[model samples]
Target: MSQLITEVQPDVEIYIQSIYQTVVQRNPHEVEFHQAVSEFLESMAPVIKKHPEYQKYAILERIVEPERLISFRVPWVDDQGKVQVNRGFRVQFNSTLGPYKGGLRFHKSVNASIIKFLGFEQTFKNALTGQPIGGGKGGSDFDPKGKSDLEIMRFCQSFMTELYKYMGSDVDVPAGDIGVGGREIGFLFGQYKRIRSGNEPGVLTGKGIGYGGSLGRTEATGYGCIYFLQEMLASQGLELAGRQTVVSGSGNVSIFAIQKAQELGAHVVACSDSSGYIFDPNGIQLETVKQIKLVEAGRISDYTLHHPEASYYEGSTNIWNVDCEIALPCATQNELNEVAARQLIDNGVIAIAEGANMPTTLEAVHILLANNILFAPGKAANAGGVAVSALEMAQNSMRLSWSFDEVDGRLKKIMQHIYQDSIEAAEDYGFEGNLVAGSNIAGFKKVAEAMIAQGIV
Candidate 1:
């Protein structure tokens, strides 16, 4: 992780390293969190040199730690009438800009390390959106797959019964992530309302449209990534039109990214799920993918059943092997490693936009940058989801909703600004055209400035 930091003044690099060491000591065995902190601090070396006051105020040290970490036991009864328990967590990382805002993920991989990493990343991601939202993240290790609807509802109820006490319209707003989706959000929202005996839709986002969700929230993250990609490509005098694309993960993010990329004239040739990936040389059939993933909640393998022309691979990561000019990793964190990055680079990948948080490893990121490939970090590229979530919060406060076009327009503009802001921050700090450093610096400066203004708390 220390090797990730480069091109820094000696004193600044030492300071950054020291802060990262303390972070690791304080949170041992939290590999994901350590990776996130190290990657972020790598960008801070220049910032520390440019802004000496940040060091005087200990911004790096303070920013790495969370304001609060809440863990509780979620107890529920399964369909077999047996009692079950799972650990739930909420890491309120930072609220300097505004209230805590992030998402709740439900998966077997949920742990303090993962949550902290996501929350830490979310803090910067939210800051880049130009929206009044801070950073936080929560979830349980309860796997929703293969669970009955009733069982899932019971779990959500139990989770909400304990979580609602810390949530409110202006306190913290949680949306959907990995395992939690519209159905799960509805259950959590219902339990929150039932417990408080009040109607406050603003307390939660990614809700059902009937219950106050925004029209374009589902499509925001994917569309926003493409928008950011558009700006990044435009910066290099390139365009997305007719470019060969490969988007990993067939979930909401990947699906919408493919759809939007196609709309903008990119030909998405490959997409995947946890089980496997499909390479459709004729361009992916979005409707069939939507049916398997969204409608039936089925596997990506079923896609071949609908269209015999497409080729399905057994492993998910192999999707990168397909030659493409644009590669968007929309799957889990670290899904694309140095090897996959080399594959992309050797195969002539011109651009990569992370639709998932930290999907590419630190080494992979360096390799891509070293190759002069246009790369957009997830914090900046994937801010679309939370950007639209903030818009949903605004709509809820106003008791009104905007049309899809309206919300989408706002989302597009926000992404444009984020791209510009990142580039400006990078250039200002002598890391010109480095979106990774640019995004990290821009977001850290925003939150750090706010934290300083608010004083040591």
Candidate 2:
């Protein structure tokens, strides 16, 4: 660690320690939650030093503890007339900048600690986007896999019945994440509208274009990551053209990343899902990948069915060992570890951009920085999704819609601005192109200033 980063703010350190202890006591095995908290504290040390008033606010303590943690019993009837109940949570972490803006995840692992960590990260990430959105995250532990459409609809209605009371277009706007998609958003939004008894189009994003959704929200995160990587590569007189890229996850971000990389003349060799990964040395066929993952909703193992030449691996981590010029982890937190980082470094990978939140572990980040690899953290690189969501809100509020090209052009501009801002902030902080420090400092300053202006609220 750099001496500058090692100099901890005493109050911040104490607060972080308290959070760590409390979380550990509650969920001792949540390694990812602990890792997220540690990274937040490490990045926040400089913020505390620059804004001593943050200590007065005890922002670290307040941030660790959400403003409101809503957990409810979600009971719904299944297609078989069987009753099912699952726990749902919404952690409105902060509201300093504006209304809470974040995604609602629907995975089996959703919990208070996970939601808290995600919500906390969203605060800074949303701030970095220069958007008038605050931070909050909600989700449920109920897995949406294998559920009938009617069953899923029932569950979403049940979930939103409670969520709608606390959310609005100008209050907290939710979007899709992890297991939440167009279908899920449609159900949730329908329920919200029914309960609220009014048509509030801006209450959610990632809706189908027939609704009030923006045109480019689906591709924003992936395309934005490529834009940031392009800027980084350009700084070194390199380009994505002819570069070999590896992307993990077969979800929205990874799929669009593959498409954008191919459009930029890069050969994307690998993409993965929860079941495993598929490697196509001749470059993954984007259409085929889309059909298999998106249309079929099948495991990546089925990818070999379409192209027998492609090989399938049974684990997600193997994507990092495919020897590519660039690596993008679009899966989940800590997908890239020290071993994977070392493999990429040894293979001469030039750059790494996270398409997922905190995909690279702290050790992997340290190794990448030590090796001088161009790396863009998820907060800056993936802000395009949320930025476009904010734009969607604007469009909804104005009862307007933008053309696909227009929305895409705006997304590109926002992404480029975020990259340049991060770089400039890094240079100003004496790090000189270190985007990790740059993003942290850039995002921290905005939220800290907002908190100060809000007068300790």
Candidate 3:
């Protein structure tokens, strides 16, 4: 389990330091956890003074620790008839505002710190959505990249066999993340239904649309990021259409972000995957990208096969060097560091919308803010996925499905609300134009108030 709560402080309060020290006491070596806690806590000094009862009740200490951290082993037989074992985890971080809601990530790099950091950030992220979902995250060290369908199904079944005992429609509900996509979610949901013997579609989200999944769920994060960007720009009397944009990652978020941006008349010039990036000055061809990366599940280098006019680099990092009016980091945590941030500023990048969680390093964010570049933090911008997941849960509960347009409209409004709310929160605490602080302050306050109302747990 992992945390942030807020109000405003002209000074750093001792209570904030004490609570942060409480987190550092046990997670001293978990650097990601440390960073996540520190970022959230650092912005809560004013909040501490305003809500002294939070300090009296030890809300910070309790919020920083997971309500429950479940860990178990998942064993499955590989295609080679070899037994493979991987660690599985579900950190139910909080349920103050609502039941635990988050995504399950599957990758070789999954570990305690990564899960904690994600779960901690998720607390505020979910709060910002103005939804009933609280915060949580789960994943495993099992990499699904080269695994066969049988191996994946076997692993998913095993993972759910141990996990089902803890999950319920009214309890923790997990969707997809990094390695957990529609394929993995289908397998996981099927296994859960088989074990639970119920049609509890709400127990999991990001399911196949035919089976209780919400329309526009897949495209939500990417589209939502752009929607937020549009709102940000509109506030400045600017616009997104007819702009040169660069996006990182060829995954679900980036691909859909590129699509939505194009729909709005933006020319997406570059996009990257693990192998490298494809740059087309004529603007990226969505169909060409989907063919190579989505349908073929091939490397981005193959993009040249269909579009000879485009160029592909050997590594993804260099894609940041290309110039554009806007940048979207949809790749992974801290993908855009200080150097990459400088490159974007040099290219006269006017705005950045994060489509991935914590994509920009702290230093990178500082540079962007200092240069007066409009920035939308991932918690506020990339919230579309979870927002749509919550919509999916609502559909399951009501035994009804929303039309694509209906879902998209709701998502757009939610994104706009998140952006507007962040602005007011920032100004409320003297963090005007600082979306990083604005978002943190806005999301944390809601959860903090909920915790106070619920009393000490």
Candidate 4:
């Protein structure tokens, strides 16, 4: 019940407490946003000591608030000639680094709180990529899961009708998120082009390759998650090879994480979706998963249809019960809670890397850290997607595209740098191996310095 940030040392605790209090008071009942701000701030007591000027300039206070919050209505007609209306949102949290950039999530759970929380996390996630992009996020409560193509097109058109005005190549750039994949991105980009009357492919990332999309964009996040994990393991004189891994979510991130982990010799035996999870002791077949989830657009349970030897469970959280050496929560926010954390730890999970934003709850993270599990926060582990998105922007701006190998090599280097930076930042602050705190501090210092240099906005 008591405030978490105020539990630190007396001097630095006051600053963190003050900023979080302002966040909670200004945005009441936004527990997700508060949780995100708290996660970043609770690790920042060492940062405030290193950069006393952060508070002098109110950096934390200003950074926690959004630069702009745009909420709009999207109305469209369904296949049955029925009219539907949905609320849309775009929260440009901060632009101290560059133009506003993040994904546009389309899920039934979307709301101001979720958007704000995601945008706040994106701030540092973007920063960690070492790219010249800021943090922002947008979405609608419209679930595209069961919608027809025409219906989805109409909804995207209506959503972009108002969203296009505020976006541009060098301005705010929105990409794809949950339920907003290549199909949705294509629809949105087509509508943005129709309304704007030009070929501004730079306005969005995660686009199809035919339309200026960078190679490896789709696999970046999942691949990057493993790359960071690889680096983390190497730091401990270990490797992903021969490790049994359990990955949650059958989406882009999870699928590719399974792919890369397998390529590196890690046996990924399980992956899940909204319906439930499929555990394949023989190892998850990447192509089979791709066909079922991506091509067929079916639940992960269908994975069993391909390989009858695999097992399918009915509950999403039950995936945590499977014993494995590695656990990757590539699903939505707050999915892996304290109970799941304990389950994974007890089951001998030596490492947990997040491929989704805030997938691990704060309590879960504490449990993992307390048990000495190597934990990779979403910001550092899952930055490959945005890093490649930034690379896509670079290619588009230059009117050139790189080969798949070239793009993948660049992504590998960026992820390695991020891992090294977090390690260095943590070691410099006397908290070696505390990557969560180190990543937050490393990203915060960069943004705070830039904010101070630019003067108050």
Q: Number of clashing residue pairs in every model?
A: 0, 0, 5, 0
lDDT of each: 0.94, 0.86, 0.88, 0.92
Worst 10 residues of 3 by lDDT: 1-10
Best by lDDT: 1
TM per candidate? 0.99, 0.95, 0.96, 0.98
Model 1 C-alpha lDDT per residue in residues 46-121, reported as the tens digit of each score: 6787789999998888899999999999999999999999999999999999999999999999999999999999
In candidate 3, how many Å is residue 453 off?
A: 1.0
Residue-wise C-alpha lDDT for candidate 4, range 1-457, written one tens digit per residue: 1222323457787767788888899999999988998888877776777778987998988999999999999999999999999999999999999999999999999999999999998999899899999999999999998899999999999999999978998889999999999999999999999999999989999999999899999999999999999999999999999999999999999999999999999999999998799989899998999998899998889888889999999998789999999999999999899999999888999999999999998988888887899999998999999999999999999999899999999999999999999889887776678898889888888899999999999
Per-residue CA lDDT of model 3 for 122-228, tens digit only, reads 98999999999989999999998888889999999999999888788789999999999999999999999898777999999999988889889999999999999
TM-score of model number 3 = 0.96
User: Cα miss at 452, model 2 (Å)?
Assistant: 0.9
Clashes of 4: 0
Can you rank all candidates by lDDT, best first? Answer: 1, 4, 3, 2
**Candidate 3 Cα deviation (angstroms), residue 327:** 0.5
Q: For this target, which candidate reaches the highest TM-score against the unseen true structure? A: 1
Residue pairs of candidate 2 with colliding backbone atoms = none
